[model samples]
Target chain A: MTTDTTTQGTALADEIREGAGAVVLDQVAKSFRGPTGVKMVVRDLSLSIRPGEFFSLLGPSGCGKTTTLRMIAGLEKVDSGRIFLGGVDATDLPAHARNVNTVFQNYALFPHLSVFDNVAYGLHRQHVPKAELRHRVMEALALVHMDGFAMHRPQQLSGGQQQRIALARSIVTRPSVLLLDEPLAALDLKLRESMQEELKRLQRELQLTFVFVTHDQAEAFAMSDRVAVMEGGNLVQVGSPEELYLRPATRFVTTFVGRANFIPASLVEGFSASSPDEVASRQLSESPDGEESVGAEPSIFVRPERLRLEIGDSSGQIKGPRVRGTVADKTFSGGQTIVRVKINDDVELSVTCDSASNEARDASIGGAAAVTWQPSDATLLDR
Target chain B: MLGRGLRGFVALSYVWFALWFIAPSAIMLIYAFGHTAGLTQKGLVNLNHLGLGNFWQALKYPSGPVLVASLENAVVATALCGVIAYPVAYFIARKLGPRTRAIVLLLVVLPFWTDYLLRMLGWRIFLSPLGLLYNGMQAVGWHVNYLSILDTRGAVMIGLVYNYLPLFILPLAVVLERIDPLLLQAADDLGAKPWTIFRTITFPISMAGVVAGTVLVFVPMLGDYVTPTLMGGARGLMIGSLVASEFTEGQNWSLGAAMAILLVVILVGIVAACWLLATGVRYVLARARERALARVLVTT
Candidate 1:
């Protein structure tokens, strides 16, 4: 009997999901009037979030990440463009009318309400049957491991507990798309890490699409199935974490996603020494000939972890281009130690190695060293 | 050493309280219980003739009506202030930007720059038979008689409301502004309509301000003599004017002291009743909610 009801519930939910539709942003733009005059917070941005997928909008502060999330939730109005939710235009819909919910950065739980009432707020708004509301609220609380805290007021709970209740409150309504605006930003490091895992697990278990916004790259990369990187009100790149880290399309994406060492292509042997703009034009001009076009004014980007450090002439055994430099600085951070090498008076490259590695342990500041990496590991981009 | 310092501080505070509060109250108590011996001196009282005659006289028909009328006028004025101030306070707190909020708040307190007596006298002139309001009303072809509305209960109530409106708005604005905007956004995200959000969240959270503004206005308006004296002519007699008469015109210090003590007791009782009522209502509502929750849980 229980199995039968569960299946029926899911079937009903699936029908509802079909009616709810995926979130589509059609060239949305938003701006705010400030003392300095009207400033564009979000430029013409278009993106679509798939149903039941963990999508993230990642960027630094003032990068329009939060604004985009708010726009999707209908808390913000687009200056131009239409938003479609569940295939229905929701650009003009008030926040209360949209079938989307947001877990705010500060949790934003009602301090005047108990955990149970907070979770059941949306249900009450829809006039859900009391018994069903209670059941669903308890279930949501249990999902966040806060079932026993239903009677407690939000202020009585710790920060992590409050965040859980916030999650429970947003999810209890079973919104088609849940928007989390840095929900774990206020938590300490350890709590944030654990909550990130919990949030991902909850998203999967509930089978709900999530659109998370955060400036912390690691937090966004860890949980999102696909991440959209934004900068200066424009969408820079959108891809999976590995795809973005390995092949960043722009210099901002390359540095924002993770640490990358950018070396002038002229410094690498065998590449023609030319200005970045000259190389770009050359590559553009040769591109119509059906030949592989090398980047103009090309700069090589290699992840610090991929760079190998050797104490002596190990270029013969190395399979890629090598650079001779002296160690300028070494920093030991629990699991890994970062060594900065000065290749020239104007250039410095960082190499990260495991703390337990013999090369990292033997490396001394001001000592001569050589850094090498495979050609495939180095990404060539127009400077 | 710390304990000795704390003890010293407490003793100093007690001395200050006795000098400022207790000594005057003690003198009043003595006068309320004693009698004056046929105008031998203005401030002298005979301890040997101590009795309840003054209390009896103060509680008689005329004084009783004065107290009742004063209470009625204060209650009506306070209610009016509350109804009118809430929207203004809410607007200033929620709708205005920081710069505008500061300016509005300053305007709310601007009347305080003038003396209270001067403001009441100004009202007396404004509401007089030939005053601005009377002439303006006549000019609008209302055929209303000039100066007729002055010195009436309505005039007294208006004066009280105008005088205490600022007191009501300040505390209400303070409490309303302290509420986080994020909570309102969260409520909207939870699918609460505007009215429901206000009813369930805003109203309940701002109750503290309502009660605080009420007490601040009510307690002071109850004992106000200036507005009633200036605006309330023959018909607007109140406990404050009656009490003043006993001391100044009647030269019955003992009777005035007794009446003043009675007013204090009444105000204290009103305050206590308000507090108890608020707590009782909260308790009952909480119990009802718990019962509702219990029923839902059992049924599920």
Candidate 2:
């Protein structure tokens, strides 16, 4: 990672790589004194964001993802645990001193300063020469396509424009880690789509580590190199987007990321079988200690898109896992038909098919049908 | 129909009430400008013939010593109060959270509960030759001059500041309260240091408040009579006391009326200046905003 530091004064870019400027959080916790006294918000959280990596903390509101991001930025004090930025103890450093800048959900731009001055501020603090400061600010603004907006105050900018300015301001400083706290939440649909593309492009162009926080799974999947799904102030799963979707560690992760249909099955001889209630009870009692196992099943999770629809009377004849149901409802979506099927027990499961094939299958509302999927497609989850 | 008629009656009553409030002042304005020999009015609204004689005589009356001293005391006291109250108000408004700020503000205004005369008398007793402070100095083997404060210009200034200090702070706090903490944080995040943040953001935004508080403290202090009479003794005679003397002791009703008009004119000027200052500040801020928008338009 040691580059030509001979010309450039303490080359920040080269130093950022090789895990030299990586941020590591070790066992962080934050608690507030409430009416019930000392309730913890983020409990014993630990994670590492590598240099040049885009990581997302995906969670529902109050899941403490924002708290974790703030702690990394040194904006919030950690109750316990250590934060190391570039292998330096930054747990006690103020936000200004940390080698990180955050784009808040609200954009938090200085209404009094023009976009140029706002972006130039951190450079000015560093005492970068005026000419160089202007050049750098313009360059960063140019990256976000906000170069002409330098003199505009934040209030005058539209929501998407302001968000880009916020990104530009943080990126101009070239901090090792750039944190985005739900930066696109305020944008409308069209703006959010465009900004999403711009944000991904910006991250790649700069090669700066990005730790973005959002509850939108689609957004997390779109931008993150790795996603950490959280629930009740705990990290339920941390993995790549594909890994999370294909094999979710918990039922909560499966449900949070996308829709899932849980069907009761029994693990008989390494194959999950549709078991009756009596055998399920016996298995549940016998496998009490197998609670943490992924295959311990009273319920099996299956994605709607993975289910294969077949004509009626194939329930008992199918070689593998299958369920008999009647078409409860159907929706035409131009490219595909989404059919909601009600099983023998009146449990609903959504299945998707190509519109042409759906018409060929002759499935409609109230039509008896059989939905089949392989055992591998259904991941047994602790329901 | 009945409700509408009742509403009409209420509106009529308000107009009558407003006329009642305006009638006395209207009569006084007519009297002040009229040519009056003691109690006899020579003409109705004939100021051209009267021709500033009343104002000129009032200004020259009693050697003008009281007028000079009072204006001097007020100028000094108001300036001093502005300087002293600004930082205190800024601290309470910006530094403390809601609960602590409420308590601090209460403490600042608590002394106003007592009678104004009692407070002035208390200050007099505290500074008296035989008072506790004087006695304490004597006990410490120090000889302090009692004549300095018993009835002097300094004592009058201090009295004026004490009486009007709260007036300055309340408006100052109001303005400071409206300043967003995020504005300062934004400045800091951009690269401005703590002092720079205050200089560019906090100080300029608070200018309106400073002007407002100055007028609040100064305009009233100019017309104050009790503090000067009680503490200034002989040397502390101000414009207010001169006007008081002309009306009460000298028995020059016309002269007093003229001087009172002068006081009103002075206050109106101060108010007009404040309005202009406020308007100027707002204009500058609006121009800055427009420039910002124009720049954004050019850049975008």
Candidate 3:
């Protein structure tokens, strides 16, 4: 490697292929010496990401999602864990030595360099040929649709343009795994939505593994192939967006993923399985009386969109478990109005209805109604 | 669009500057153009005949050489300060912990609060024949000669560097500290080695501080007279000492005024020359980069 500089530089420029850019973290933990003392930020987090997958670490701030991402990027060291990139142990490797790159928050594009130079930075570091560097750099800029602003400085571009340049710079190296630390957080709402779609498109087209870190759960749901929700330095749950949304495992996961109405209840005896099949079968076989007969207390979680409201003079049969309550409050949000139904002693369940519907418009506060939801929609969760 | 109170403040500051700076400059200009009185006690300057003779005289053989030497000394001293202060500033800005950084900065500034003349005197004692440094060096088995070292250009250079180092470090440190560390982290993420990151990002951004610290040390060093007077016996004499002697011992205030104006001219000329040279170099490099990029673009 030391004999031929040009060959070595080109040799290091291996692009991540489709099935080789897997990232694995084994019992990774991190701690910081805070003002108080040594405080743990990430505790025993272990997960394996598939190749060409869009993975997200979703959590609130200070929950160590960013720390975990940094550890994988080799920007932050894991206290005691092994990180494997492309089947190579990279725990002790520095950020530059690892086959990875990061798109930072606020798009830390070099203010001194033009957009073209910035996108060419990783290529330059690999000492790629000048013609190829230019071709690939322009190719990346074209990918982000920022080819027109290649001559402009990073400071001269707007926030969205800078973001595009940042994206181009990160992907120019074709690293094994691209780490994104809240890269879309600094943009405005409309821009954020468009960029989210753009990012999803880019990830699919590139077939590169993307490790996205964000606190916004909705953004994770919109972009990830799999999301690992974290809380208090612990991996609370990991599943697909639909699986996690429908079958939340804990009280935190229930409330954090979506707006959920939780009812205090208990599981029936002899339902020991935790798989989806067991949950669905139990939902079909059990009656509402079984919830009252159980000794142990648990919470039944249901999303607001799953509940249907029946007003006075309804001739239709209630086929599922229903809660009899009076309408406590009605909030008229555009497209959807949330009507809070107060049932049996202070348990208020919010049922979302279309704002343009006759029932939503005619529903009055304190009116008697029955809020019915399918038993399959509710998940018995642990606190 | 200015508020009334701010307008008043602006007016008052201008008046203060005119009274303190412009008035003295006008008096100096008058003396530069006039001549010294020989016998007629019509003040120190004879206003009957005013010419460019004094300016020419000041720009000629004796004072001309002294001014050139002074410029050389100031240039070397300023360069040395920049080299020595850059690493110190970088260490304090980037490497030290937050708690230690404040302490180090305080130590850097602590010398500024002490008496300047006393510090020069301390350097004088250290460089003397029987001083602690001379004996300490002798004890280390090097038969060094302090008889030649004392009252030399080397001693004066030391005094200048020691006296003006804080000025170089303070502004440079402030600028280096203000550089976003996130940029360096980004570079590291983008496959930059530590030295490469420093070369591409840290050093270029720190050029602002380099220029500021250079000016802070260089301009004042040109106007300094005390260090050369105390440490420079005769061979190390600077233009400042010549100007000082002309005004005091020689009592030729007209000649002194002319020398002062000429010194100002030389300072401005050197700065403008450097600015032009830097601009030319920057333009050439930028053109080369653009041409290289254009070549690549054509090939692509």
> Which candidate ranks first by TM-score, i.e. highest?
3
**What is candidate 2's local distance difference test score?**
0.76
Worst 10 residues of 3 chain A by lDDT: A272-281
Judged by whole-model lDDT over C-alpha atoms, candidate 3 comes out at 0.84
**TM-scores, each model vs. reference:** 0.90, 0.82, 0.92
For model 3, residues B69-159, the per-residue Cα lDDT tens digits are: 8999999999999999999999999899888999999999898788988887887788788787878888998776664666888988898
Go through the candidates in order and give the clash count of each.
8, 6, 0
Identify the candidate with maximal DockQ: 3
TM-score of chain A of each: 0.89, 0.88, 0.88
Which stretches of model 1 miss by more than 4 angstroms? A1-21, A267-295, A314-316, B1-17, B37-43, B49-53, B145-147, B295-300
Q: Give one digit per residue, the lDDT tens place, for model 1 in A233-266.
A: 9999999999999889899999999999977754
Please provide, for model 2 over A353-383, each residue's C-alpha lDDT reduced to its tens digit, 9 standing for 90 to 100: 8888943258868888887765557665665
What's the TM for model 2? 0.82
The positional error of residue B194 in candidate 2, measured at the CA in angstroms, is 4.7
Per-candidate Cα RMSD to the true structure, in Å, reads 4.3, 5.9, 5.2
**What would the per-residue lDDT of candidate 3 be over residues A71-180, giving only the tens digit for each residue?**
98888988998999989999999999988889999888888888999999999999999778887887677777886677788989899999999998998888878899
